[model samples]
Target chain A: MIASLRLRAAVVSIVLLAVFLGAWHLATRSTGTAANMSPEYAKLMGMTATQGKSAMPGPLDVGAKLWEHLRRPFYDNGPNDKGLGIQLAFSLGRVMLGYLIAVAIAIPLGFLIGMSPLMSKALDPFIQILKPISPLAWMPLALYTIKDSSLSAIFVIFICSVWPMLINTAFGVASVRKEWINVARTLEVGNFRRAFTVILPAAAPTILTGMRISIGIAWLVIVAAEMLVGGTGIGYFVWNEWNNLSITNVIIAILLIGLVGMVLDQILARVSRLVTFPE
Target chain B: MSIFDDPFDADSRVNAGCICGQHRSPAEHEHAMSALRCEPVVESQEKRYENVVASAVLRAVFPEATTRRAFLKTVGAATALAAVSQFFPLKTATEAFAEAGTPEKKDLKVGFIPITCATPIIMAAPLGFYAKAGLNVEVVKTAGWAVIRDKTINKEYDAAHMLAPMPIAISLGLGAQPIPFTVPAIENINGQGIVLSMKHKDKRDPKDWKGLKFAIPFDYSMHNYLLRYYLAEHGIDPDTDVQLRSVPPPEMVANLRADNIDGFLAPDNICQRAIYDGVGFLHILSKEIWDGHPCCSFAASREFITSAPNSFAALTRAIVDATAYASKAENRKQIAEAIAPANYINAPVTVLEQVLTGTYADGLGGVKTDPKRVDFDPFPWQSFAVWMLTQMKRWGQIKGDVDYKAVAEQIYLATDTRKVMIEMGLTPPKDSYKSFSVMGKSFDPTKPDDYVASFKIKKAS
Candidate 1:
């Protein structure tokens, strides 16, 4: 029954995508005659426009551009114009660096916060205050104080990603089964050993859940952050294409961003699954 | 100082001939030696240490044991140099300019808002001017005019493509954190246009623009001031009669199409782009408002100039060279191609060509060629700065009696710019304060207060 449901869901997704593309194509058809404007203006409008209306691209235009980008994703013409692969690498490199930093600081600090009531109580107000702020709000302050745009971008990601993991790890550790700690205590398992063996295994699933949440939030924030910073990233690429009024390139970037985000989420989900056990 | 060439004495280092060794004539030596100034001259002279660039190039070029010596000894330095020149142009290139004291900082990032007014600043990178001057410079495409100013202020950018009015505003601490900024050279002149949406093509006169929405690149930009002046001269109050918003040059066309703005007085290729897309029509070239009006400028902070003078000089040399190269009508098309890639302006090649080549469709069915339609003369005149100050005063941007000449002379690096202009073989004007006319009204630098007070349709002062 589940397998049938999965197959049906896949079919439905395909149908929806096809319908969307068909609608897009139908909606953007050239409605105006081609001869009203001068030859000069017509040439400047590219293939999208015939008359005076916008050449906001259809699916066909995006698909062709997407294919072009995929064929040569690593071409580096210069500093300002890099291929999609290079741009993605720049964004991913920033994200991973920021994410790893968050992990290193979060997990250990979160363990302390969860283990000790005093630490958790002390840190709670700060986390509550900081968590709700939009990541891009921190951008100008970071750029000003840090005096480095790239590092500031990374710093924003780290600040934004740290909160969820920290909260979850704390929650997971605090809610561990009491019997596991008692058992370890009775057997003369050292404090470090108890944490590494019993508490860790019990809390692993919840901690992984937090990490997954953080990764999703991190990916979302990076696009906005890079767009605001405007250097080299998928966000910059999208903003740049928009500046040039290339809606086709923007569509391609959006598709790639969604695809990359899904891959990131899936990898985190896989890791979460690896640590999960039956009740 | 030892006048004699004592080979055994360590103080004397072989009165080094020009690296090419072909031009040791008295005239050539005079030319080369005049370029090499005395010690403690430009910014990078104080590593207080070694000649790292030359040694590094030598080490990288000849890594083999004793190969540099062997090449100099056996193969005869000239032939070896001839072979090396194909790869690195060692024989022909000016080594002085490369090593010119040492760059205190090499890898520099110059910020620029993506607009064709920044042609010289942007084209210099792709055309190898920066590299030729022994600097590894990256032209960072900034999102807006405000960001460019901020980045330059925060030291994130070594220099920036600023509006000619910006450094003056920045130095005065108007609408920004007070940082002493200096304009080394103007980037482009007379490259803006008043473009209206296609709906208003018939509404050609400024009087028809009452309650019409308009956009300018920045308030501190010549675009805004010129637009204001043009409107006021036609008895239209820009403040009340029409609306003006500051949109980035890239978004001007889209805004026009979206009906967000009825028109804009903005930098190219934005004006050209609007004409190209059929969304907007070119109403008037900005040169019609004020011929030889200054636009974008290559600006650096006082901190940058004071700390890295040689680097500053080298970078300015590259910019002046580029500006001189761009000033010529013949080179405009190739410059358009050079900066048309995705990395730079990212506009269509045809759009860039039309803007640069000065032959563009007026977006109203007629092709026009005003050869000086858009130009690149990088002279940062003191009088231009004074005119901007008066405009700034004319608008409510700066209040309180401002001393025009002192501020203009300080911010506009006319003397330094003159030195560079002369070095590049383009003769700068004899006096930095030359008068110019705007809309049939002549502006005298001696009386800015009179100029500001002469305006009737001003914001209530």
Candidate 2:
């Protein structure tokens, strides 16, 4: 029965893949011909006519180009050297580094503010002021201050990642059960032991949710930051391909970004699951 | 000595027992011990002397190794490697010949906004200029300059008819990816104008551009930069003296009409449309402010330029030829008719012809005609580029000192441009540089490097 189920799942996945590719192929072919049928297209198409040669390349021509690039994808073009793998790795590394830094700074701050009314009053104004500012708005200042594109991009990711995590962490820490604290006090537990043993475990699930949100924000900011800064990153790849006027390549880049983002979120989801108590 | 007499003595019973196995006379044993000690000491001394001599020989033979000789060898090897790498890149570019050879990537898509400067591109497409150059060009209509820049950088289009500064700004990585860009050909020059709303007629005259609220289109846009530069020349601070707001190009006329903005800088065609509608009047033509200023050009990726040199050259020739044709009086009507597609500006033939011909009725009953209004001379405008670099420095768009000559050399490919001009029987100017005296300050293009260095501008240290 298990073997049959596995076989059925495999067949379903294969069929889905075939259907997706078939739809893509048909859509591109139809659009390609329609675009060429216009008068403007005819004028442009006339430019490439050699006595017997075809002027405009059809969808097959672009597909061939795509296949050619896919075959040897590790080739380095110039100073922005590295394959797509290396570029994605660089981008992912920046995202994680920035996300971790943000969490490290935000969590403790959130805890302190959440625990004390006075502390919350002091920090609330600043948080409210900063939360509404877009990540793109911070790019110019970051670029000027940091003087390095890679670090600027990382800093942008950090700025974007911190807010949701901080808010969530504060809410998580503040909403801890009053009964648990009373239980710890009756047991005559020390403050440090009580805080770690009772408060932390109670807040773990919420804090993990905040971390998941932070990671997703980091991933989103990194792409825009990389595009603005320019270097070996997935964002740069998208911008570079777009500048070359390759629409198919742009689609490919968008797909890569989406796939990578999904994987990152899934990883965070798994991590959160491992830490949190089952419902 | 006896063992019981002195337990710590050298001649104790334990010592005597040790010497009992190989017993010899006292004088002979002493002599053997002395010989063994001296032999080792002599051998060690000899080894030390040999080491010193060997080190001295090595030092003497290769005295210059630490200095000049090693340095020269390293430099020579580096130079050779650099030369080889420069000559042979990874991907061999396909040659783009006008008369022959297949276009490497033929189904070309280009993007442009409806600006007067891009009139030639609109004209060229319908007239088969791009086709003649072996480009299957598709002109994608963009919303505005920002969208055009975004789309161009994103690779939605192969090339673009863009503001001259767009490519430069993008290449320098001001706010976007440092895409390598080059203007293969100049599209048109001196089509932009500054206009004032009718509400300003009582407060300010047409000549007084400084006393009004200047509605700039976008930050870091050419219109904003140029307006700021023009204001500064007249001793007006754009920040303190007047309120500057960011408004889109399509809304510039409406904003002025609604009295929301006092004045705005826009292209000639749009300003003329507003004047014809009796909403606003021409304050000053930016062309008059800086005559023969390089405004817009046909920009392409550096990758495209390198990959398809022949195609680039062909495209340049086509643009140059088209510029010549469009400038002639006989071809003016035909050029206007060709560009009248609804997807383009959708303006009547008369409006396009008047703007293209540089004949403007100043909206105050006066007509001004300048024959050489928009000079298409590619080489002499290196001064304008230098001027722009200086302005960029002044406005904090660029930081640190760039080698102005090198930047000019990269952006302005005089050799290729001039070669195309010569083939067309046009006299390509021998002198590369020109001098401009703007607001009584003389800027010599020949001394561009020194000129940029001497400017009192805030630069990144």
Candidate with best DockQ: 1
- Residue lDDT tens for model 1, B49-88: 1222333345578775356665556666456545555676
Candidate 2 per-residue lDDT, tens place, A54-88, comes to: 22234465567558656776666433334676778
TM-score of each: 0.83, 0.49
Quote the B-chain TM-score, candidate 2.
Answer: 0.71
Please tell me how candidate 1 rates in CAPRI terms: acceptable
Worst 10 residues of 1 chain B by lDDT: B37-46
Model 2, B9-46: lDDT tens digits are: 22222223323222134554444332211011112222
Q: Give the 10-residue window scoring lowest on summed lDDT in candidate 2 chain A.
A: A44-53
Q: Cα miss at B459, model 2 (Å)?
A: 9.8
Candidate 2 C-alpha error for residue B71, in Å: 59
Fnat of every candidate, listed in order: 0.46, 0.00
